[model samples]
Target: MIASLSKISSYKSMNPIITLSPAILGALVVLQAGLNRKVASQWGLSAALLLNAVVLLIVALLIFALVLVKADWFSNTIRPSIDFKTFSIWFLLPGIIGCILVFGGPWAIAKWGAAQTFILLMSGQLLASLIWDLKVEGIAVSYVRLLGIGFTWIGVILACKWK
Candidate 1:
């Protein structure tokens, strides 16, 4: 294995968000399937339910850890370019979990699985987080996050109900 990959994997082990993403994602996927007319299965639903709780716990723990950061605003150090990592993991954790619930499995371990699921999940997570921040902490709106959420929703709807 590449040294960088190994190093990142090791670091991820320590990062709760990174380590628990897949399991939480898998769980959300199962629950969404259960609710949907197409993917409902009793056993899968149960497993998914468990995953949902885990993801929520992880997310809550993450918020709790933010006590150390001492700032709620975006960092000036980050730069003008959009950061994919921020969008994928931080802003969109919940909806991403939802997407994972809908499409996560062996086949989708790293493969292209469902576009709508991906888009909707991203939108729901990022925008919802922004809304939460706006309400809780009076966050100023950022053009990029707003744009991304709007664009992501387009992708979700197209993917889920395309003709």
Candidate 2:
């Protein structure tokens, strides 16, 4: 674990682009949430999710085809190593959770507006991420981190204020 942490730190130091990727993803999530809300307003939640799913499927397929053509790595190394017997049913939770995220995001945006929804979503994500880091990864939870989480909750409350 220490080796992995050192490796990640080294890699981050070497490639700053990896650090900036999350910020880009955060902006994209906000954009996607707004677009999802608009689509939901026109087509309803289920139809919007379905449409998004279809679009994502098409894009993923295209990417996969390109990867297959450009590199023999996945086919030669990754695909051949599949062990179906070792796979658990819990592996499917990501898709189920994704569906929930897709459905709930637009609903929250419609009910609360984008700013409030984004704040609440970010708060929830921060809290969950902290807990996951501490409990699952056995990371030490510092006082500063706790204080940050408290501030995030306060922000969520302020954002949720009806007035």
Q: Pick by TM-score: which candidate is best?
A: 2
Tens-digit lDDT string for candidate 1 (7-79): 8878766879777887797567644543542322434544555565687689877755563363455455532
| Per-residue lDDT of candidate 2, residues 1-163 (tens digit) | 6986898888767666777888898888878878988998888889999998999899988877776677665566533345898999998999889888888888887887888888888888888888899899998777888898899888788768853
lDDT of each: 0.59, 0.83
TM-score of each: 0.35, 0.80
Candidate 2 clash total? 0
Worst 10-residue lDDT window for candidate 1 reads 105-114
RMSD of each: 14.3, 3.7
Model 1 vs truth, CA RMSD: 14.3
